[model samples]
Target: MEMSSKLLEKAVSEMAHLPGIGRRTALRLVLHLLRQPQGQTESLADALLEFRTQIRQCKECHNISDAACCEICSSPKRDRSMVCVVEDIRDVMAIENTGHYRGLYHVLGGKISPMEGMGPHDLTIGSLVSKVKEGEIRELIFALSATMEGDTTNFYIYRQLEGLPVKLSTIARGIPVGDELEYADEVTLGRSIVQRIPFEGSLKG
Candidate 1:
């Protein structure tokens, strides 16, 4: 808990703020970095700084990218008509790892969690509605986590798209209830995507 150097203390403090990292782990990481060559540490700092400063959100799907549009959104090989709705970039990465889906994505940024003060306006739902309105998207696949918040967010979007011509579907419940898509194994996630069911059917019981 006590560091001999104030600089080391500061470094550990900042590192501990990262998700899943505790003060002990942060101190260990800081010590490891100190033991590394000076250039390597500098390179890491530079990379983090550049990533924080230069990363952009894809203009179409809100995925983190190096430019205005992400590679998936801009790729002609992707099926633009099939848009998979996910909670964030992590979910996109998870689905991409499965390699079962060739469709484009729309990152909702976050779910509607009242306890966390995350609502529809706090997310990219408006643009998603606009995309559906454009009629270019023929199918919308809900790939959100199986938690209550995820279902709430999905139902909200379903209501918004009522009467729209787009085919609505959700990933099959191959994933355990309340599990995050990002945490599911590639095979299960792939099967879920490949064997998706109609949204209306998922709502019944």
Candidate 2:
């Protein structure tokens, strides 16, 4: 791609670095932004900067938040006894959109993947174990993707909770194996949550 301007080339390069965006799409976006009023571009830049600088992870669940705890974790209506474990904020958003789960969530940050060099220590697994050991969470629901790494992470956490008096469960197999929870349709995900089975069965499968 020959750039008429260095600034345009730089903008396209930066935009193309985003996931799922190619150089052409980035160039189109950059051109569109250039076509907009200067204040409009400034507002966009300001919003992005503010989000990058001001965003914080919820102290309780590790979900994205502006404060110490996320709104769901701080809410009185949420069922603190039931904690649903998920991969990241996108999974949290996906589950929240279903409106079927009124329980609290513990975001693991990511799954254990040896190829990616992301192990248990790289995630919030330790914090989750601490939350469970506090004896407040009675039921731990595994809502992670059905990938091998997801299973490994779940089993690792399950082992950590051995002898604890918490009931363990996983979302039903309505979600296809190797599929991410965030990609499942709301109805299917909701049903899976409602019909969750014992975590032991997941280990066997």
Candidate 3:
């Protein structure tokens, strides 16, 4: 349905394209923005533009950052010896929110999904392997989703690390099967981290 007002229609359509937003909700948001002081809306637009252009992946951990390395990677306070492997930046945020981890992270970028045609080559697994082999790393924590692809990815990484000096562990399965790490609450996520278990699976690959 084409909206009669061109500017309003454009705003609503763009908002609709964003995740979890519908045309009606977008219209409401636009109206709210319009009602605010000009400074508010203008600053918001500028900030959005800045975020789009300024953010990049961290060189070491692949987390989102405004510089070459994210705060986590550069921070001396974080524990580099314990590296946590996550599927994406959202998982990093979720874990950080829990305040349960002081270690570094390696973003796989995505999981190994054969049906979706995503594979190990498409991820940063090779970089993770290289990072682990660099030594001084004590534990490699797998904090991916509990989905089938997530399991496949975990098993694959586990096999790759066999006989390596690093110990392989995983966040507890308290996170429901099919649930993403990004959605788990801080308490649950914290508990899971505190109760992580070692990988007992035999790597087929």
Candidate 4:
């Protein structure tokens, strides 16, 4: 799309790079921003700048936070013995919305996708294994998606802690095959967490 102003064009180009946003949508957004109060636009820019510069990953779970540790990780009410392993903060948010899980979480950053060149070593799997080795975590729940890559990552972690005393379980099949945990409705996701099965049992099928 042709724009009269290079500033608007640049803004639209950057916005278009965001996922699910097209050039048209980005242009519309940029125009809307221009029409808004100058202070409002400045505030938006300031917030984004602060977020980009100040955001931190939770040291324990690797979830995004403003401080070294996320609120969930530092919460006193959370179940320290149960840790749900998820693909990322988005999955963590999805599971948290259900309110069914009261345990801690371990964000894997991403699944093991050989096609994408994502391996176990590329993720925070080492810290997770070390967490289990500490003997503080009693159950490690695999809350990753049901896709091949997700399953592969789960199995890989399982093998790592096979001899450890921690119990390994996976969310139930309430989530359909190849479905992402983030897209599932709250009811189904909550039920899956409530009715998780042993990791070994999942391997049989």
Candidate 5:
């Protein structure tokens, strides 16, 4: 691509670094921002800066939050005894949108993928085990993707909590194998949560 200006080229390069965004799309976005009023661009820049600087992970669940703990974790109405385990914040958002789960969530950050060099230690699994050992969480629901990596992560955590009194469960198989929970339709996802089965049954299927 021919760059007419160094500043534009830099902006496009930065924007293109984002996931799913190519050089052409980044250029279009940069050009759109340039076409906007200076104040509009400044506001956008300020918002992004503030978000990057101010965002914090929830102390309990590790979800994104402005404070030490996320709103869901802090809410009195949430079911503290039931914890839903997900891969990341995006999965948390998807589950929340379904409005079927009222329990607190524990974001693992990512699944155990040897190809990606992401192991159990690379995630927030230790904190989750601590939460379970604390004896407050009576039920642990595996809401991760249906991929092999997701299953491995769930099984690893299940073993970590061995001999614990907590009941183990997983989202129903309504979600197709290899499909991410975040990509499933709300109705299907909600049904899966509502019809969750025992982890032992999940192992058989």
Candidate 6:
């Protein structure tokens, strides 16, 4: 069946490519955007373009930033001695939204999954090891998910950093297995921060 205008169809098609958006929702959103002022449309386009043109990865932590280094990495108030290791940029935002953490972060960019052709070499694992070894950091917290892939990645990093100067720890167990950090409630995430445990073999309790 023939649909609406080519422009409307185009917008919906593009939106449908996003993670959770479907054709029906995308069409509704396109219609909603169509009713907005032309300036609003222009602003959206500009913002989309600017996302890449303006933002870049932080050299130190590998997080997204408008500058070479993210504000978190440059902030003196942030605990340079503490570094939270996460799988992706989204996890960084999830943790930052809680406002319960005061340390810096190191985004691995992805988990270690041989099935998907992602391995330790593909992530920032080496950088993390080097960072912990420099003696500038003290704690390395694994805040990735509880899924199999998340566990694999965590184990990979933990083993490599076992002999480093920093303390290796994992978030508390209340998160429940198979849960993604992005979907975790802030209260649970905050509580986990307080009760994180030392990584296996880190030190005798």
lDDT comparing candidate 4 with the true structure: 0.92
Instruction: State the lDDT at 92 in candidate 5.
Output: 96
Model 6 is weakest, by summed lDDT over 10 consecutive residues, at: 196-205
List clashing residue pairs in candidate 1: none
Model 6, span 172-194: residue lDDT tens? 66676679999999877887778
Off by over 4 Å in 6: 175-205
Off by over 4 Å in 2: 175-205
Report lDDT per candidate.
0.94, 0.93, 0.89, 0.92, 0.93, 0.87
**lDDT (Cα, tens digit) per residue for candidate 2, span 83-168:** 99999999999999988899999999999999999999999999999999999999999999978999899999999999999999
Candidate 5 stretches greater than 4 Å from native: 175-205
Error of 2 at 26 (Å): 1.4
The candidate scoring highest on lDDT is 1
Q: Give TM-scores for every candidate, taking all chains together and pairing residue i with residue i.
A: 0.84, 0.84, 0.81, 0.84, 0.83, 0.80
Clashing residue pairs in candidate 5 are: none
Error of 4 at 34 (Å): 2.0
lDDT of 5 by residue, 19-62 (tens): 99999999999999878889998998899999999999999999
Return whichever of 2 and 3 wins on TM-score: 2
* Model 6: lDDT of residue 156: 84
Q: How close is candidate 1 to the true structure, as a TM-score?
A: 0.84
What lDDT, from 0 to 1, does candidate 6 have? 0.87
The predicted structure with the larger lDDT, 1 or 2, is: 1
